[model samples]
Target chain A: MQPVIRLEDICKIYGMGDTEVRALSDVNLVVNTGEYCAIMGPSGSGKSTAMNVIGCLDRPTSGRYYLDGIDVAGLSDDELAHVRNRKLGFVFQQFHLLPQLSALENVMLPMVYAGVSSAERRERAAEALTRVGLANRLNNRPNQLSGGQQQRVAIARAIVNRPVMLLADEPTGALDSQTTQEVLNIFSELNASGITVVMVTHEPEVARQTHRIVWFRDGMVQHDNMRPADLAQMTLTV
Target chain B: MNIIESTRMAVKTLTANKLRSTLTMLGIIIGNASVITMVGVGQGAQRYASQQFESLGPNVLFIIPGSEETRDRTFQVPRTLTLQDAEAISSQVATVSAVAPQLQTQQPLSFRNRQSNSLVMGTTPDFLSVRDFGVDRGRFFTETDVQRNTQVVVLGSDVARKFFDDTDPVGQQLRIKNISFQVIGVLESKGAFLGNNQDDAVYIPITTMSNRITGNTSPYGTEVTFISVNARDEASVSAAEFQLRNLLRLRHKVVNEDDFTVRTQKDALEIVGNVTGALTLMLAAIAAISLFVGGIGIMNIMLVSVRERTQEIGLRKAIGASQQDILVQFIIEAIILSALGGVLGTAIGAGGVMIVGAATPLKAGISTPAILLAVGVSGGIGLFFGVFPARQAAKLDPIVALRSA
Candidate 1:
């Protein structure tokens, strides 16, 4: 019914004087509800910065950001944190699962902040882990899990709160090819289940799996295009 | 976040670094233990002193000659108290139970071949009841002995042992100040009082003392060191003291400052109480500094922990943990450390007090208020010192923290 993330001419500048660097410049982007999209760019292309702004992790220097119809630019730090907890889930390249917590606890963390009851948090976290094919690895800590399993745990943590949008930053950047394919299959299944997923990736092949790709370069969005599976199949047949 | 969740997380984190946590807690433990032990010992000393004063016979009052200022300023105490003044107090003061005028001097005591420096106390027969001394084997001197100036001596229990080891001391002759005096009776053992061994002193008739040895040091009458007056009862102590002061002031005549000072047992108890109380306070204050230092130690270690766990903080924040969550986590960790240390220290300190009670004469006791205060103060110190490091951890920018990690 509404776009899950919307940014209008967002500019994020770091440092001051001659050392100033524009991490993101005049960026306008929108991802509607239930859309799976990939943001692609080289190093220093502001793709990560855009993902940060969309995820409510950092504020923009100038311009408006509406996350799930709420004005994120006007919210306080705690309010932004609540929005992150309730509306968006994050999967990092490093899997950022707290090493001290088991996979189940890591997944339950978001719901803890969401004020969910302990029993419900346990139930939902278990279900989320099962969704990521990590039901048997619930008691394993990040150190004990394989790279792919750790990534899956991180993904479960990201989606355990049933966030409106899932934001992943190079989710398979640290995994082998076989593990990367398994993680992508998980993401595909998650997107198919009606959750909007946005990922920032340096791999062209990774971007090709998504329904749409938005390319970023030199602190600006250079191109955006839809490459639906049916259209790709039609192109291959032609 | 709920407090339970934060507390659990805090406990988890602290237990993760068990050695570091214990080392951090050591300062608080020592601080609390010293505070409890010192307070207990100080209070024990006060109790022991009070008990000693109580054992000096009930409802006893001392009438010292010369004002406190005069006593301090003069080389020797002015002999304002005399046998006449003691008689006046006994006759005129209705509240007085008994009056024992005393004159003390260190004299060489000789019997056969054994010779010892003995403290000789010159007092009337009333000294037996007024000072709570009893004859163990023989009878004390009669009032007629004082009137007749009899050369009779009463040997204290220890004095009897010292001179007549296997032989009977009573009815035996003991030479004092080169004057041969007969020991009429041996006193029952009255142990040490304020470091002075009462058993080492023997009593003689006041008249005999003024006539034979250490002649009159007072102008008015037989010069006495002080008058030991027993009140009729505990309630009559103040009244007796008042009447004694009035009699002495009238007898001294035209006094700008009364040349005498009367002190009751309660007054002595209070003075000892105040001294020991102040000492206890001082010890606790000094120990409190260590608690403060312990707080600082906690702050220092927490700052280091915050710096070390930057990634963990960043991850928590990114996972939608508010700054308050981070703050509470770190603060709770500190409180847990200090609170645990406080509990442990209290146990150790109470045990130490028990050991002291068993080992020494102080009757050392555990003070509940002190234990509660030490534990409460340690917890509060944790919260106070934790704020800075927790704030530092909370204020860390997640993006920067994540980048660094």
Candidate 2:
């Protein structure tokens, strides 16, 4: 598989002088296409910072980032937004589905930014919702849907643009175990369809389900490709 | 995102908060309504004044005492016009057809037990034609009546009805200022003009009125209130006015600005139009302040809305909406609110115009250009005031926004 993402010496700093906060320090990473990976870390470990950078929500203070083989280091904010729209899909802890839009409309959003015609947007949104097992719930508002259903709609929205990768941060953190499994199953199915999935979760049980784990501590990766069985039982710390 | 898409989104968002949206539009609604109604009333006043002036009789002109500047600042008629001026106009001016020298005084008149203070107009026989009055009964007193100082009076229809109800007013005698006068004629009913009932006064000879009743005679012959002159035809009205002014100036002599002013019906109508136009402008300017205030209200509400919808902004941003898209969405929402307000206000204002037209003497109508201007201006105000708040929304940091949510 080709490398969909490569990071070289990525550093993100948050303040100046004595109050300076380094969210990421000399972070180097390479994630391949179609890889299902989990980034695990405790509080202030910079995993969220990495997610932000990888999702192109924020720019790095220093270093080069290549997404789908194109370096994103020198892109403008608008250009970066385009990259995010076309190449990356973000799923958040709260699902973040727009309350004003229906499931179908929410799924149509990225395509709207992509400037797709309404008919095409509707058709593609329906197709995406159907793939997420939400064909009958296409017109339901976010408030009208269950938590699990809302998360599915969010996932449908994320994948509607046919992005290269899915970037989820604590995606199932607000969900119960039953809904979490439903989310994990969808992620697995999407991964099997040749989409890379990078998720950040603190739960070892969740991390064990992924193919690879990158654990962070003190704004740096303490371990890469670690398996749960290789760790000290359920200590859950790197 | 395209404009259509943004507009659709804006409509959805605004509809989701119906009360807030309606409340936000209240200012624009009131502002537009005032703007429209004020302009309508002003136009109506101008029209009424024009009608009243035109009804003074065809091709009529008033030679009033004092210069134009003096009359504007004072209520005192300068007594510069008299029978002499009227006689000179009727004889010397070629464009003149008839002249009515008028003197007016409110006097107590009694026919037996009916005593009332009524307006008494003193004039010669020419008052019938120059003032567009018709004698309904008996003949009007002739010019010989003024020469003899005969105490002959013509009763207006209203005065005839008041003093001699159900009986013929002609040949009846009425006492004015303790002097007895015989009614020789009755004039036809003339409708009110500018709030004064034209058919509610009595007419007498100017010589009898000055010598026997009021006893206020001037050495300059007769001090008439104002001289009413009619041009030979409609085409001669302005020419007549120009000639009258020149002749008066020559009579008064060595004038810098002249002591008297001759004005046509058209001039009076123009003066009325200017006054009403200024009133309309003042009203519209006040209404504009409200519109400006409404625009500020929109900006204030939009700023709050941006704050309230920060999470939504963040979510949309994360989902690939650019800053420009968010900006467009908010601005479009403001425009929709304001334009809708304009339409509603126009409806209310037009209804008010119709009601005013029906209930009052003013025939106010809904002006089309005013409607267009108000609606266009409100829409423009929405766009103008919406920019800062929309920019505030578009410039929010997505990461911080999401974290707050």
> What fnat does each of the candidate structures reach?
0.60, 0.58
Q: How does model 1 do on interface RMSD, in angstroms?
A: 1.0
Model 2 per-residue lDDT tens digits across residues B214-307: 6765556678888889899999998899898888888767358777777888888888889888988988898888888988899999999999
Question: Interface RMSD of the predictions, in order shown?
Answer: 1.0, 0.9
RMSD of 2: 1.9
TM-score of each: 0.92, 0.96
lDDT of 2: 0.88
Model 1 residue pairs with clashes: none
Error of 1 at B235 (Å): 3.2
Local accuracy by lDDT, each model: 0.88, 0.88
